[model samples]
Target: MRHPTPDPPAPGQESVWDYPRPPRVEASDESVEVWVGGVRVASSTRTLRVLETSHPPTYYLPVDDVVPGALRPVDGATWCEFKGEAAYFDLVGGGTSAPRAAWSYPRPSRGFERLVGHVAVMPGAVDRCTVDGEVVVPQAGGFYGGWVTSRVVGPFKGEPGTWGW
Candidate 1:
């Protein structure tokens, strides 16, 4: 299924339609925080976000900014045509765990080399994920890792009928 044309962007907002097809990665200085099981497992001022057409941005936190021992590698891998292979991780902190709640592309594709070793979490798998102090909503599908912030306007991809969009 496919979604209709994207909505227009209001002032101070960005339309997902303007994002790239192959995707682009940009460094972000905004504060991105992840809390799981009642504990802050990751907080970073330096992060990377991938912008792709029809999808909300996917923020990638450097491993250094994440709590030590907070991520445990899990068994399983997925491939992204644009980002290369991704490995999954469990968010293990505060005596709680969310399996395959995070992922990283150890050896990202050429254009996405900066993502190597940087982890992007599934917002739905954590208690909450915040960007610039605003709590984020997870992109609708369980498979995509995009984090939905108010700054982005979408009829975003990841919904039931948007898989082919």
Candidate 2:
């Protein structure tokens, strides 16, 4: 699957888009703070950024830290050639014992191997999760954004396929 890149915001504007093709998903090995069930989940690792949006920015997290019994798989899904098929999950608990939240590719396309088995949750859904020790808010609904306290550009809003690709 190949998705074309939309034009970058004109020197000073911003655009959000998620298309297929050069799957650009990255992850970190470092442990990040993930608060679910209002308690911090230890060993939760990673920060991922997806390069496109119509809704909000998507953040990725490691499954280790998220409470094991928190997520309940749902039938929801969205598609993009870049990362591949995104299966959604409904948050079971609002971050306490088990916090179920939004997540993506366990089987991302070849280009998006970085996101394999990585889960991205809604910041709005959790009590707190910090990037570099700073708290963050989920950028988009049903998507994920890894503590986007400081970002250089914006095409913000994790809505897929927004900009003209």
Candidate 3:
């Protein structure tokens, strides 16, 4: 499948095309929060984000800000060439449960060491997720944890026939 042309970024917005192919992880100062089943499950002012081509940024929260007993380690692992092995975690707390709703890299690759032990939740798995007060739109196709916000412009990946890109 051919890569579709991406939309031009609007003023004050970011174009996913401009994101790097190898992906980059950086500390994010924006406030990131998550709610599930009417309860606040995670809130963090010190989050990190992973940015990659054709994908929205995936925010990772420090384990300290996530409510205790909310994440339960589960079986299964996925590999990312740039980030290394990722382990899944179920979000369970506050009368709600989302299986395999979060993931972390217990031993991230060299450049991604900051992500070790940090959790990045699937926005679709929670009732709501926000970055800097803007509600997050889950990246298309359940596989990627990227969060779309008004500040981003994309002809994103994860849709039908776009995988080979």
Task: Give the residue spans of candidate 1 off by over 4 A.
Answer: 1-3
TM-score for every candidate vs. truth? 0.97, 0.61, 0.96
The CA lDDT of each predicted structure is 0.93, 0.57, 0.90
**Model 3: lDDT of residue 147:** 95
> In model 3, which regions exceed 4 Å deviation?
none
Q: Model 2's lDDT to the true fold?
A: 0.57
lDDT of 2 by residue, 13-34 (tens): 4354433234345555544666
Instruction: Judging by TM-score, tell me the better candidate of 1 and 3.
Output: 1
Index of the highest-TM-score prediction = 1
Superposed on all Cα atoms, the candidates' RMSDs to the truth, in angstroms, are 1.0, 6.1, 1.0
Query: What would the C-alpha RMSD of candidate 1 be, to one decimal place?
Result: 1.0
